[model samples]
Target: MNNVALITGASRGIGHHLARHFYDLGYTLILIARHAPALEAFAATRDPARITTLAVDLSNTATAEPLLRQVLSDHARIDVLVNAAGIFRPGSTQTPVDDFSTLLATNVTAIHLLCQLCTPWLLKSAQGRIFNLASISGVQPFGSIASYAASKHALVGYSRSIARELGAQGIKVTTLCPDVVNTDMAEGSGLAADEMLSTEDICRAVDFVMSLSPAAIVEQLTIGRQPRPRQPR
Candidate 1:
């Protein structure tokens, strides 16, 4: 059987692009998104036999595991798990409690839940991989996006801890921290389209990580644009 890849946030942006990339690489894909119709709509473009789509609200942490279990019924093993589903709310520490809760639930909690759920299946595969999409904010806090940054920082820490925990089992965990990819999420973040990295850049980084031998492990990979030349004002 082809290697199985389970990806969350598969309906659009980075997730959507990764889904397509993996499909091209001949991996069987289990795509999950919040909306069934949108998820299925993308799945329709791929070979039906190799694709499985599920609608899951990552923010609903309590229900995620059960929903994931239900969908994995067909696949005996998951070679890769990509935690790409995330929420970004712009605000400082003063951001409302509800927004903070929502960001934490979706960004950090859901990733933790899915990692636990997929560990067994991943262990069964010879080349197991887990890729977590974090951000530059994960490593350094920004005043404007305090809550979002906090959650991402948590994710980065969690991912590194698990990388050490699962390393002996031969499962590689990598957290990708990119600076503003040109996705819908970054549209209004006060950055021009040309300034952000493309989805292709993200996929290429993933490909590089996957290409390494089991002996090599990358705990975190940070991708960012080079500093633009300062226009003399």
Candidate 2:
């Protein structure tokens, strides 16, 4: 049976690269994101039998389970789940409470909810591992992207607690805290202008997380920033 690694936010960025990485490693994929056309296009470039996709907005209650259950029905087990779907709304999140709520809904809330729903299937995989795309922003205060940062911060805390809870189930949860990745997420931000992490680097962390022995559980792995180059000698 082909192990299915379900990757959310698969249309772009680290999710996109990770999807390719797993596909090359002979794992079937269930790629999910909000852009159906983009996903269809992306999957076209991969092995047809091993790749499937769902363009779903996790914020919609009706969409999440229907899509996940569909994938579950076809694949006997979910070997891995990478909760990489996130939003970066960088502006004055001034007075709109709904905006903040939506930010949390997409980033923190959806990741938590997906874990809850996928528990049984993941446990059935037995060797399964879960990875959440956390950020260094979680550990430090971000200047302008307050809501986005706070949501990611909450995700790290939530992931820690869940990792403890799921340890007995043979499930490993890893929170990837990479400082300033050079993805669409980093573009336009001050962090982008400075040296940043690469999607390939993050994808490697995901691969490493999945490669661990059943007994080995990595609670948290932080990929630190590169040292700045000297300006003047």
Candidate 3:
């Protein structure tokens, strides 16, 4: 049987690119997103037998676990679990409490819960891997996105701790921290999409991590965009 990879946020952006990349690598895909139509559309483009689509709002933590259990029940093992679903709200300390809560639920809580739920299937794989898509904001404070930063920071810490705890079980967990990717989230933050990293860049990073030998592991990786050339005077 082909290895199975479950990717959240597979509707677009980095998650979408990663899904395509993994498909090319011959892995069966479980694509999850909040939009059912989009997920189904993407899956339709692929061999239906090799792809599964699940429309889920990970932020709705109340229903996430049961939903995930139902979807995962059919698969005998999950070789890769990519927690790439997240939301970003740009704001300072003045950001509303509700916004902060929403960000936390999607960005941090969902990843944590998914990891817990998928651990058993992961453990069954010979080379199980977990990739949590965090942000450079996890490492440095950005005043405009305080709440988003806080959630990513929490993710980074949690990923590292789990990596250590699960290493003995042969499951590797890696936190991917990238700075200003060319995505809707980064564009919403007022960054120039042309000047930022591409989804391919992030996907390449994931490929590298996943390609490592079973004995080797990258606990955390931070990726940044290349500097743009200065305009001539």
TM-score of every candidate? 0.97, 0.92, 0.96
Show the colliding residue pairs in model 1.
none
- Kindly list the per-residue Cα lDDT of model 3 for residues 1-233, writing each as its tens digit: 99999999999888989999999999999999998988988888889999999898998878878989998998999999999999988787998999999999999999998999999999999999999999999999888789889999999999999999988898999999999988877765566767888999988899898777767899999997787789999
**Cα RMSD of predicted structure 2:** 1.9
Q: Over the stretch 1-233, how does candidate 1's per-residue lDDT look in tens digits? A: 89999999998989989999999999999999997888888877778999999897987867777878888767899999999998889998689999999999999999998999899999999999999999999998798899999999999999999999988888999999999999999878777877889999999999999888768899999997877789999
Clashes of each: 0, 0, 0
- Candidate 1: misplaced stretches above 4 Å? none
Name the top TM-score candidate.
1
Weakest 10 consecutive residues, lDDT, candidate 2? 88-97
Model 3: worst 10 consecutive residues (lDDT sum): 184-193
Candidate 2's TM-score reads: 0.92
TM-score of 1: 0.97
In terms of TM-score, how similar is model 3 to the real structure?
0.96
Query: Clashing residue pairs in candidate 3, if any?
Result: none
lDDT of 1: 0.91
Give stretches of model 2 more than 4 Å off: 91-95, 191-194
In model 1, the worst 10-residue window by lDDT is 58-67
Whose TM-score is higher: candidate 1's or candidate 2's? Answer: 1
What's model 3's overall lDDT? 0.91
